[model samples]
Target: MAFEEAKIRFKGSISPVITPFEEDESIDFKLFKRLIDWHIESGSHGISVTGTSGEPSSLTIEERELVMETAMKTVDGRVPFLPGTGSVNHRETLRLTKAAQEMGADGAMVIVPYYNKPNQQALYNHFKTVAKSVDIPIILYNIPGRTAVNLEVDTIARLAEDCPNIIGIKESNKDFEHVNRVLLKCGRDFNLYSGIELLCYPMLAIGGAGHISATANVAPRQVAEIYNAWAEGDVTRAQHMHFAMMPLNDVLFRDTNPAPVKAALGMMGKIKPVLRKPMELPSKEIQQEIRETLMQYALVL
Candidate 1:
């Protein structure tokens, strides 16, 4: 299928879903399926997984594929499912992206090559190759904080011009000017999304498609409402939701991601507070802080 012919339009609060794990450090498909349903039920606009929040590094390739298959089955086209299919290795990124395309994903979110810190020209070549390999829309994931390299606006604009399937980006970058420049260079129709929680509304204000915020993992409806409200022409409500989410956005990142997020979910009885080795839960002080933050929204659990 050509990118134009594909029916799904990636937008709104596409949750970078956390992979639920059993207490024994196994993938918890049952809980995973339920979590997908919960995000849908909670009015998240789309579902995405195997991204940073999903702990993609911890899972084997086979485990990632199984999770993707289960997500496809469970989502059942109710909302778009975009899977993170990128890796540091070029071949691995290609293989996983092809796998996602085969699994009926609405699109693939490919991160910039990390660790190796490829040059802009190399980044362009790598993404163009990946885009050519799959017909699905390829949204570039530019998270310099974790990746240790920035996907410069010029490079991204070049890819947008060169690869039709290479669409917009999910920027976790803190530089507001850089993001603004992306929209200016890539044109407003480019499907830019904010991966940073605090910038979700600000991004929308400047023509962002939507967000894939980690905050959505704990507060889906409120998070989605920021976009929905803005789309509905209620700037006041959208601004309100944005500020409402600020404390949550702050608390969830008191520690590393998914730890506080998964811990928050666990406290709400959504999933086990289990993480694979080397990724521990939030400290007791942080957990208590997370608990108090959730209470502000009346999430007493």
Candidate 2:
């Protein structure tokens, strides 16, 4: 697809797919592709991998590229592949992002440099440089909760103004006022996406293009239905889906993401809930909560 077409299509419930691992810690490419196919067949709007949900930090650079390559081939252009290609290291971020572009991804989502804590000006330069490195559409990822530093609204506006390819952002922030300001400053057409599950509907209500929600990994159809219902002008149906998903959303985040999410998938017999070392499975309490919630959703018997 052309850049404009891909940018326009890069909306709705884009599932940030998880990277399934075997008990021996090898990447389960087969199960991973199955999950991607499941998301598409179940009506998810798009597919993404190697973001927070996919445990990109755990994968080697080559592995991330392989995942991106595998995902695009599996998708076969049915949906846009918007993979996270950012790392704290600038060179690695550029390299992976360029790789994603070469692999024909619809867009590349690059997170703010974490741990290093660069100021706003530094943030602008970082994003501008990455956006220029390749012609692929760039979606800025701002998750202040994990990254320690927020990509202030001014910096976001600056990047949007400076880089034509820097088209959108995935805001995982909880501050309502801040997000509102982002729309006003960056312009309503700025393809804003809510990375936070609770704010998905609210973000769309304010003219957001869509979301990169992790919850979509478990409840793909329901999540996409929220966007589909709203897009079809059924506000009531969209709101119902929003509320219906609240319970599942809460339980999934009962522990740090991906953990609870991965465990839930394991219970559904999708893949083993194995995480890399230092990032273990959710606690037993969290697991029980996930199990019960999955039952409530009828995702598992």
Measured by TM-score, the strongest candidate is 2
Q: Could you give candidate 2's per-residue lDDT for residues 1-301 as a string of tens digits?
A: 5545655789898999999999999999999999999999999888899999999889999999999999999999898788999998899999999999888888899998889999898888889999999998999999998899999999899998889888889999999888899999998878899998999999999999898898988999999999999999999999999999999999999888889999999999999999997799988888998999999999999
lDDT (Cα, 0-100) at 147 in candidate 2: 90
lDDT scores of the candidates, listed in order: 0.91, 0.92
lDDT of 1: 0.91
What TM-score would you give candidate 2 relative to the actual structure? Answer: 0.98
Model 1 / residue 291 / CA error / Å: 0.6
Show where candidate 2 strays beyond 4 Å.
1-4
When summed lDDT is taken over every stretch of 10 residues in candidate 2, the lowest stretch is: 1-10
Candidate 2 lDDT (Cα, 0 to 1): 0.92
Please give, for residues 1-301, the per-residue lDDT of candidate 1 as tens digits.
Answer: 5565432367788988999999899999999999999999999998989999999889998898899889989999998888999889899899999999887888899998889999899998999999999888989999999999999999999999998987779999999999999999998888889999999999999999899999888988899999999999999999999998899899999998989999999999999989997999988999999999999987654
**TM-score of each prediction:** 0.97, 0.98
